[model samples]
Target: MEDPKRLEEGLGHENKDRNEQFSEKDDKTKGGDGINHEKEETNTVVVVEQKGDHKQLQQQPLVKQKTKRVATLDAFRGLTVALMILVDNAGEAYPRIDHSPWNGCTLADFVMPFFLFIVGVAIALAFKRIPKKRDAVKKIIIRTLKLLFWGILLQGGYSHAPGDLSYGVNMKFIRWCGILQRIALVYMFVALIETLIIKQRQSVVEPNHFTVFTAYQWQWIGGFVAFLIYMITTYALYVPDWSFDVYSHHKLERYMVKCGMRGHLGPACNAVGYVDREVWGINHLYQSPVWSRLKACTLSSPGSGPLREDAPSWCRAPFEPEGLLSTISAILSGTIGVHYGHVLIHFKDHSERLKQWVSMGFGLLIIAIILHFTDAIPINKQLYSFSYVCFTAGAAGIVFSGFYLLIDVWGLRTPFLFLEWIGMNAMLVYVMAAQGIFEGFINGWYYKSPDNTLVYWIQEHVFIKVWHSERLGTLLYVIFAQITFWAVVAGILHRLGIYWKL
Candidate 1:
């Protein structure tokens, strides 16, 4: 409840006023007309109102307590942010946890889907009761724009990475798509869909098995339509030979990749890559792709290394992982999340919620397994295939339910308090830690040389030197230095009631 509360409280600047208005409405509608207000039981308390010996027993509706924020949702979201920091920071030294080279699931590959899934779940709670549709639409648009602006600002190939002490991006080659950008697109469409279609909160004493499904049938249909479009475009599009130009030793060089193929899902020739190139342009796409680490491209196989002698021309070409088609497919994750949020809104009983969540979770997993094993979809994160959505969304549901069980149901919130803190202000942590804004700022302060910053010294002397293992040291640095430090910052912010929403 705390998790959804944080979102409802922080997501929009106007939510506070909106909540107050709802409270006022509740107060005014406390008589015969308001008897069936939003799932309220018919229990009433006697009020004594007397006027000169005429004793009258007036019954007042028992006001329901405000819904507390879901600690489980906060903890679960915080866990996702933590995993993002871990994988992004430590994956370079540990390839096992890194994103899959091409068409498999890895720890790192789950991060994006997990993020999308969280957004989906949050949308359900955020739009539980939309008092003013126009205002809600305006807020959604503003937030979506903010996400887009930040995504482009932070990840638009402008800001230098940790090691580089440089600023500014080459506008000509600035990447237009990234992790946040994809999230922005998904959030915009999903939030709009929910805002446009959601009915007013209705009282349901005992919602049948298909109540949630029936309520959100349009969202499901939209998801299916999007999925169908993705499938058709993926399988029917004719991909021809594509070429990209790059400067090699200050000389302009062009490389042509012969990919006159259709329905191919390899790293070289895929409909996703083709669509991105045709739409966003090759220069605007991500320069360094995970495909470069593929066995066919690199001699080192899993880790990025020198290109193999027989590497294909497409290996060097730019590819955007969070491309247009893949992002369209990603909307399904958010749709599934909305369904979970609906369950939370409708069902107050822990057992019933868990039953629905677990059932859906396992059901999605089963579909993912069937599609993957049958070689139909193959669970490709790069493509954001149908199977990938099912697998990741299912896992997200089960994991979220586990957190709900542990923290919300069982009242075990202490152990995961740090995660809850981070979840409460996830956007702040994401910008500071995951995006390396803090690192870049810290590196700005140096003694004599740019490389002599506190960040570099700590990574070299404190972590790597102590462990004598670069991989282990890198992992520990991320855990202790980045994750722990941000956790404390978020906790302080949470205590201070300071949150960076949007």
Candidate 2:
């Protein structure tokens, strides 16, 4: 009979030595036929080969572990939020720090748009983690509703302590629309487009070689559409008759007159208050009785000390900074932020060359040039001009990219810990500061020494006394009060482990 070992050895040179060894072992244990043992051994070899193949199949890509530090993005967001708090709560907004009046760009102008943009970046990051389409849609709806509800609450749901509105004829209508409300509206619309519309379309296609362009192509298209729609709406409202000279028509002024005539004169007898009447169209659209009731109250109090009727309506124009038309530009600003986040995530592995930085810098420079020429697209925060959007977005992108490089790429984090800490609980600080939660505690009531009560002394003596000659100093004093308030609030929030989420 042919030897089983010899037959196995003839299969391959490598197998010959392995087969001889196995045969020797089998002979020592000889409780069965050699051919039966050889067959069992061969089956074991096949099983081992299959197990090895399975291990290789289960291995994940190297990139999975490497790309997990999304903390950098969160840190970037925190920095932006911190800057917002700083600017919003400046000790003294010297011309150097404050935004330009209406025509030019400034550091202050970048804060709001940067916040919105960061929101967009967050939106992009969020949709990826959610499991089902229905759940995502539900989350989007809930978030939008909560934002709107809180926005309205902040405007004046609790403007007066419970029964304060009951005082003989004291009714104040807090302006209906505001920053948070606008953010809610825009976010809702964007989320709807991204989740329900865009994702549905993407699901129908083949899975393997999915392109980012096809998936998020709608964001770009939608951004453009938003810009165009806003621009057209603003143009029509600003110059209803369609005259070449935008100044000739003054559609806003005309609208104000129409609003005033309708007896919906709003809070103060000023242009901004009047414009609120037009935008809210509260009487017509929502059937809001607040405007009409307030008007009646004012008329009833004919002899009351100068019932706000004589206040120059134009004075309200400055208050227009937070208004309807401007919100359009704000939404566009968020879109720009979304674009930046996309680039950062997608090109993380690309060469970190000087050319990439320079290219971004140049792109911003080009935008600045275009803004300089297009005076028609005024850089007005109140109007939310297209030029304002371009200038703010460009500046914000440069700042964000610089911070990303320094903190994330270069690993320089320790130096910015305090700022980062303050940033982490930013919204908490803002609400606390805005609500005067710590004003009495920090604003000099606790000080034993007369001179040590810096805030009190400044407000009563230096600000009201020594600086009495300059109006600017008084404004600066208010800013100083705001800053001191924030510092105390930041310290407290840091200690409490309280981080406010939106």
Candidate 3:
């Protein structure tokens, strides 16, 4: 009987020897003691063989036909969604959890990019299991539209109807750009690229379950081209001289006359903002985009539409950070994720896979740092700046790599079940939380009166009293309640055997 170690050997070498080593009968039957695992949960699978009466283990594929998800990706996604809920809820309590006022990355800023990256990785994995479905394009288009519809319906920053069940859907002043809208558009674009242009390089006849798309030369070509497109478009388009003076129209005109940037091609005067304003109209843009306010003008509150036309000159009109043009960069973030996905599924050696992630992750990070310091590109989330995506994607790569090493390589799954539960039903939680389902359904009871709100009451009595600070208590409660509440809900959902997608 062959040693079991052969079953766990590198797929590349073992597969190479299969034709000469095994007879035709070897391929025909499973025989005894040679059952193969269908789950591609780890980097390797143990294949077994039979010779005469002696059943023996032999080389196996790293992944099987089904390609069940690697637990690490689920953990990564869960952690990302969990943090998103935390920061979104914490905005009122902790200033640090809030997004940077204008041009820098924050813990909050990292969430969107990482999620986009996860989408890319998931795309690679999903396609491997079921490529070229009869309704593939139809499914892609439908999914894309659903995401877009939900984005506009729930997060479009439209006002509600007065004393009516129907939403206002106010066309006169509805914001077109939003978190989910950006996600939908990005996903559609990437999926189209995968389905039509990139073209999967797989071996259909051989039927090696472990084999995934190499993408090879095309991967680098796609990435480089995406970068070029973003950089050129970011800089080449013309933008008007922005007015900083909110009140004195005459002063603004005068300042525009002499300001060096007025006629210059600056980022503040780029094509992205100009096009968005024209298409969506200033009144239809995000009201609370991270922008500078001056001359006693206050920032617009969340969910508000664009500034009034009559607003003082100092009140900056909203410009979407996730605007149309920056979406190209967003797609690039997903592209990088696809590359990592290739490494994960195609590369069988754990060390080789780790090396690839480290190189890709650090390479992007270093390039981002260089571009930022050299002013080749700025790290601005508002613009979805080129450098910003590079940095975020880099961090995401390193993070997932670490999780894969721990959970998949070291076989540590039980420790992260809490995160796994949340991850499996991430989209459900996100949409529900975004639409005020949590607050409307659950918090309504808690906040009916001062006595009923357990979280606030506890904070007021315990954390505040012990810490001797109201703000500190509120911050602590914000972190604790969000994580705990969601984890419990996710746990129950997991136990109920429900998985939500799209």
The top-ranked prediction according to lDDT is 1
Q: Judged by lDDT against the true structure, how good is candidate 1?
A: 0.80
Q: Compared with the true structure, what per-residue lDDT tens digits does model 1 show for residues 344-445?
A: 767756788899999999999999999999998899998999999999999999999999888766777799999988887888898899999999999989
Candidate 3 structure quality by residue, lDDT tens digits, 212-254? 3344445446666877787776666556554322224555432
- The global C-alpha lDDT for each of the candidates, from Candidate 1 onward, is 0.80, 0.47, 0.61
Top candidate by TM-score: 1
Badly placed stretches (over 4 Å) of model 3 are 1-69, 129-134, 158-169, 197-223, 241-268, 293-315, 443-468
Candidate 1 residue-pair clash tally? 7
> Ten-residue segment with the worst summed lDDT in candidate 2?
28-37
Colliding pairs, model 3: 246-313, 246-314, 321-382
RMSD for each model, in Å, please? 6.3, 18.4, 9.6
**Candidate 1 lDDT score at position 69:** 48
Q: 1 or 2, which is superior by lDDT?
A: 1
Q: Clashing residue pairs, candidate 2?
A: 91-479, 91-480, 270-313
